[model samples]
Target: MKYVGRFAPSPSGPLHFGSLVAALGSYFQAKSQRGDWLVRMEDLDPPREMPGAAKLILETLEAYHLHWDGEVVYQSHRHELYQQQIEQWLSKQQAYYCQCTRKQIKAAGSYYQGQCRNKNLTADNCSIRIKIDAPVTEFVDLKQGKITLPSAIAAEDFIIKRRDGLFAYNLAVVIDDIEQGVTEVVRGADLIEPTGRQISLYQLLGAKPVQYLHLPLAVTENGAKLSKQNHAQGISLSDPIPTLICAMRFLGFVLPKQIETANIDEILAWGVKHWHLEQLPKATQITTLFSNRIS
Candidate 1:
């Protein structure tokens, strides 16, 4: 199979420095191997999505010359496919409906106790969770190296569809990756916790396992990850070269000084030519005062 990689971003807000780092990391990783670099809009949660945010994200990518290979996929447009998978799992007894709420789970403990696994709950006012008979507690990350999750987290029956008639992140992502033939997932380290459960989903669905490369998260001075929720400033669109160079540096790329005067295409050519996975810092999170400027 050809090496296929993607940068799936949720349209909750405009692309920030952290988002650029992830996008550039995945883009270079794919381009370096002469692989297909695809982009997908993770706009599944409408309530949280910002108006015109998705369009702005694509524009930012274009401004930075990070073009994708195919049509941009929108998660909201794939409800039927997600529902079909949900029904298939339900019929096979691999998934079950649960009425457990956040408060209830918090009362139980950090991990869900599978209280509704045998409740025989109906679809009415219920969320869907998949059975975890075989847990994947460990996986080797391309950047972070060996990662091991607690058995409680790995063994818990995670949700596939929420009670609000929305498909869960784990479910939608795994299904989309499998359908798109994604060979690797390169993103921020904040998602490292969910890798094992996603692998478990792949096992349940019998899909080919995908490789993972988690880039070090760009965090604020206080150790908070730069995120839309935190109101992190969006990357510079008016003058993107400096910001683009900063993103490449975040990924551990050492560009020539002359490249600073080059255009986006030339900068990206240098990036793809010098991309190295081993150069990336192995830390999960890195604090940077350049969160706003990133230069």
Candidate 2:
């Protein structure tokens, strides 16, 4: 089967250095394998999304020479597709509506224990959750190797739709990957925990589960994951080569000393030619230099 990878970024903020690492890693991984690398804007959460962030991300990717294949997909426009599959699951009894609130679930247990499984509740004011009859306990990650989650944790029924009539990230992501025919998922290691849930969704939907490669996460000096919520400075496109080099080094790639002076196209061309998946460290989090730049 042809390899298809994607860089799906939420437009909650501009691409930070941490996100840039993910984008470049996914882009190079696809390009090196002669695979189709696509970009999808995960703009489902409108309240969290920033105006012009999507366009800025695309421009940033282009600036880094990480061009995507085909038209970029925006999740907001695909609500119908998510809703259709969600309805299908509901009709098949694969999913059910829940009236339980977040506080209620937290009080019950660390993970959801299917409180609404037998409720047969109406959809009004209720959230939709899938029944994880047989959860995926383990899966193989290309970089991280074998990953196992406890059955209890894995079997916890997860929400598919929020009470606010918005589609959940897990549901939307799985649906989009299936629809896009994503053969492989190459993203940050922060998402490792969600793989089992997503795999369960793939099985429930009868779609082939895509291969996963979770890259190491870029964290601050204090070990906090660099994220928009953390106020991570956006990647500096003004002088992208240094930033690109920093990402490559963070991924454990060894480049020539003088390569820092190379242009974007030259750097990316070299990156594609010498892409090495094994060079990526298996560690989940690595402190980044960006933390020092914080004023």
Candidate 3:
């Protein structure tokens, strides 16, 4: 592996401070290792996407000097590929469809009891779920230490295709990462619970699993994370150098006072050369420093 990394963000809105932290952390780590850092636009769920958010995100990244190496991968364009993988899984009887409603799962209390496991049903109004194997319980994470999930959760049948005819995030991400040959994944810590499921998917697909790094969440003054739901403002693309410097500082980087006055390119050049992953906080949440100015 040549240290290929990707920052895949959902295009639900502009890149806010929280998302910026994620982007910068991943970007610096990749560049620090002298590796390729790529970007992928996760615009699979059309109903949840904003009209111009994708373009705005790219423009913002460009302003911040977080340039990507290859073409931006859009999940919407890969639906057919997901279908092909789903068909292969179905052929081996490794996957099945479930028509169970949310109301039913809520009553189970623990995990899906596989009510439709033996049911011979078409995937029309049903969601396709993967049959979880028990042994994929734990794996090494590049950031976090060894983790364990309940066997019920580890082996619980999870969805691959939604009843709404949309491909599930897990399946699509797995396919894209494998096909792209991504070697490392860095993202928010909230996604830790689903890592095992994704690892299982990689094994099922006979694809190598990428090293995982789940960073802490960026919380606000009120403790709620800065997100579209919380009305967090996007990072100002105007004069992004200061924003980039501030972000690097927030990630626990200690630059000479002179570099604080450095341009974005200079700051990033310093960043890529001195990036450290060991300094990242392992706590559940991180207090984000938001600013209105580049200085």
Candidate 4:
């Protein structure tokens, strides 16, 4: 099969330095391997989404010369596809309605204890969770080596749809990747925790599992991952070269000094030519003081 990779970002805010690292990392990985790289807008949560954020993200990618193949995909446009999978699992008894509240689960423990699995509950204001009979506790990451999840987390039943009538991240991501024929997932290490659950979802749905390569996360000196929630400053579009070079360096690329003066297309070409997964830092997070200068 041809190698296929994707960079799926939520429309919560503009692309920050951390987001640029992920985009550059994934884009180089795909381009280096002569693979098709796709962009996916994870806009399933309407309440949290910022207006015009998605358009800004695409413009940022273009500014950095990280062009994606084919048309961009928006998760909000595929509700019927998500609902069909939910109904199929519901009919097969592989998944059921969950009426448990956050407090109720917290009282139980850090991980859910399958409280609603046997409830035989209806869909009246209840989230839907899939049963995890055989958990996927570990998987080999292309860059991070072996990754193992706790038994509690691996065996726990996970939500596929929320009570507010929105599809859950795991459900939508797996389904979208499957539909898009994504051979591998190349993104930030912040999403590493959910890989096992996503793999389980692929298995449950009888789809081929995609390989994963989680790039190191860029965090502040205080150890907080640079994210939209933390209001990390967005990358500059007027002068994207500096931020783009910084992102490449963060991903362990050693660019020539002359590349600093190169244009966006030239820099990106150099990145693709020099892309090496083995050179990526194995650490999950890397604290950088340069993050403050991106803006």
TM-score to true structure, per model: 0.97, 0.96, 0.95, 0.97
Ranking by lDDT: 1, 4, 2, 3
Summarize candidate 3's per-residue lDDT along 1-295 as a digit string, tens digits: 5988899989898888878888988898788888999999999899999899999899989988789999999999999999998998888888999999888898977478888888968877899988776537887777778877667778788999999999999999999998888898988787788888999998888788998888878888778887866777888878776667667777778889888887778888988888877877768687765845222
Cα displacement (angstroms), candidate 2, residue 87, comes to 1.0
Taking the tens digit of each residue's C-alpha lDDT, what string does model 4 give over 180-199? Answer: 99999988888888999999
Model 4 global lDDT (CA atoms, 0 to 1): 0.90
Across 8-59, the per-residue lDDT of candidate 1 in tens digits comes to 9999999999999999999999999999999999998999999999999999
User: Model 2 lDDT vs. the true structure?
Assistant: 0.88
What lDDT would each prediction earn against the true structure? 0.91, 0.88, 0.84, 0.90
lDDT of 2 by residue, 1-295 (tens): 8889999999988899899899989989999999999999999889998899999899888877788999999999999999999899899898999999989888988678888899899999999999988889999999888999878879888888999998998999998999998999999998988899999999987898999999999988889999989888788766687788889889888898666677778888888898998898979899876632321
Q: Candidate 4: which stretches are off by over 4 Å? A: 291-295
Worst 10 residues of 3 by lDDT: 286-295
Say what the RMSD of model 1 is: 1.5
Clashing pairs in 3: none
